[model samples]
Target: MKVLVIGANGQIGKKIVRLLSPTNFVRAMVRKAEQMPKLESLGGYPIIGDLEKDFSYAYDEIDAVIFAAGSGGHTGADKTIAVDQFGAIKAIETAKEYGVKRFVLISSLFAGEPEKGPKSLETYLEAKGRADDALINSGLEYTILRPTTLSDDDPTGKVSDVTAFGKSSVTRSDVAAFVAAVLPEEKTYKRIYTFANGDIPIKDYL
Candidate 1:
């Protein structure tokens, strides 16, 4: 399959590109031309596309999409709304328009219930929530993975569903592993799940 990985230079996004490139065609979309070499080294076909502007061209010949773009913590509410919310919504619409088979989103833990999260993060959480809702309602085959606080720790190759284990942090590598594992999984389509580090191997849990 050919996959368009949005925000492919970001942490989890880069990992997804690396994982997918070995067996699938990857269009690793990034904001800067300088980022292309890193993705190229990972076996991805890197392309320049900004979420804050016109990026619909990145969808060309893409079979699926992974919307991993973000405004980062340092950005203000406006950037959050623009990138996390509107940007994701636009990607969804474009994917649907382009006949993409699937769309996967990397969302936050409290995205669906922003008010329950820390007040300082309410805006960010709300933006993620809106984007998640847009994908759920976009009528395109989709998977939304809402993970808890992220850490830079190494992958454990195991995880637990948050619905059963409650909130907890997870390594970025493990999250990327999970996304790669589920990309071709029909069972995961149209499913939204929150997860964190745990004992169950990712494939077994799937």
Candidate 2:
């Protein structure tokens, strides 16, 4: 599949680009020119674009789209809403406009509700949930992965439903792997599920 990854410079996005580039014609959309080489080194065709404003042109020539951008933890609520929320919705619309076959979103567990997470991050979560809702209502073949607290630990190549694992976390590597695995799987289309490290292998859950 020809896939376009938004926010290709991020912690999770970068990994997704690297994992998908070798097998698929992947476009890594970075916000700055400096990040292009990093993606090119991983075999990705890098494009410069920013989700904060307008960059729908990047969606051209892609069969699938992955919205993986974030405003980071240190940013304020405005940035959260602008990038995490508005930016994601914009991508969804652009994907639909370009006749993209599928859309995948990287979200977080406990989205929307401010009561379930840390006070500082609740706004970000709310924005993420809004973006997810937009995608669900957009009439596109979509899959949403809402993972718990992210870590840098080595991936186990295993994942389970967040409900089955309770409150938990998973490594960034595992999350990227899961995204790469589901892109071509028809079983995951239109599915919205939370994931976390567990005994069940990734394939089994998919």
Candidate 3:
């Protein structure tokens, strides 16, 4: 399958690009030209695609999409709304236009209930929630993985539906691995899962 990974320059996105590039055709979309070479070296076809602008071209010949873009914690609510909310919706629309079926979204654990999350991240979660809703209603086969506080630690290759093992955070690489593991599986379609680091191997746990 050919997958278009939006925000392929981000931490989790880069890992996903590397994981998918070897077995599937990866169209890694980043915002700048400088970000191209690393993804290329990772065995992906890197292209420039800005979420804040027109990026419809990135969907061409794409069989599936991985919406991994985010505005980051430092950005204001406006940028968050623009990228996380509106940008994701636009991608869903384009995917529909292109007749693309499969989509995987990297979402936050509190997106389903933003008000219950940390006060400082309520807006971010709200934006993610809106994007999640968009993809769910877009008539595309979709999977949403909402992981708790993301850490930059090495992957455990195992995950749980709840926080356990004294580990409250999910590693970015594990999340990427989960996406790769489930992307081609029919059982995960139209599923919304919330997970964290744990003892079950990803393929078995899911």
If scored against the real structure, what TM-score would every candidate get?
Answer: 0.95, 0.95, 0.96
1-206: candidate 3 lDDT, tens digit per residue: 99999989999899999999889999999998998999998888999988888899988899999999999755899999999899999999999999999999998887857667777887888999999999999889999998888899989998888632234888999999999988999899999888898888999976
Question: Candidate 3 — which pairs collide?
Answer: none
lDDT of 1: 0.89
What does candidate 1's lDDT look like per residue over 94-196, in tens digits?
9988999699999988795876777777888899999999999999889998888788998999988774213578999998998998899999999887889
lDDT tens digits by residue: candidate 2, 119-156 = 77878888998999999999989999988878899999
Off by over 4 Å in 3: 163-167
Poorest stretch of ten by lDDT in candidate 3? 159-168
> Between which residue pairs do clashes occur in model 2?
none
Runs off by more than 4 Å, candidate 2: 163-167
Q: What number of clashing residue pairs does each candidate have, in the order they appear?
A: 0, 0, 0
Model 3, position 113: C-alpha lDDT score: 76
- Positional deviation of residue 79's Cα in model 3 after best superposition, in angstroms: 0.6
Query: Candidate 2: minimum summed lDDT over ten consecutive residues — where?
Result: 159-168
- Candidate number with the higher lDDT (2 or 3): 3
lDDT at residue 74 of model 1 (Cα atoms) = 57
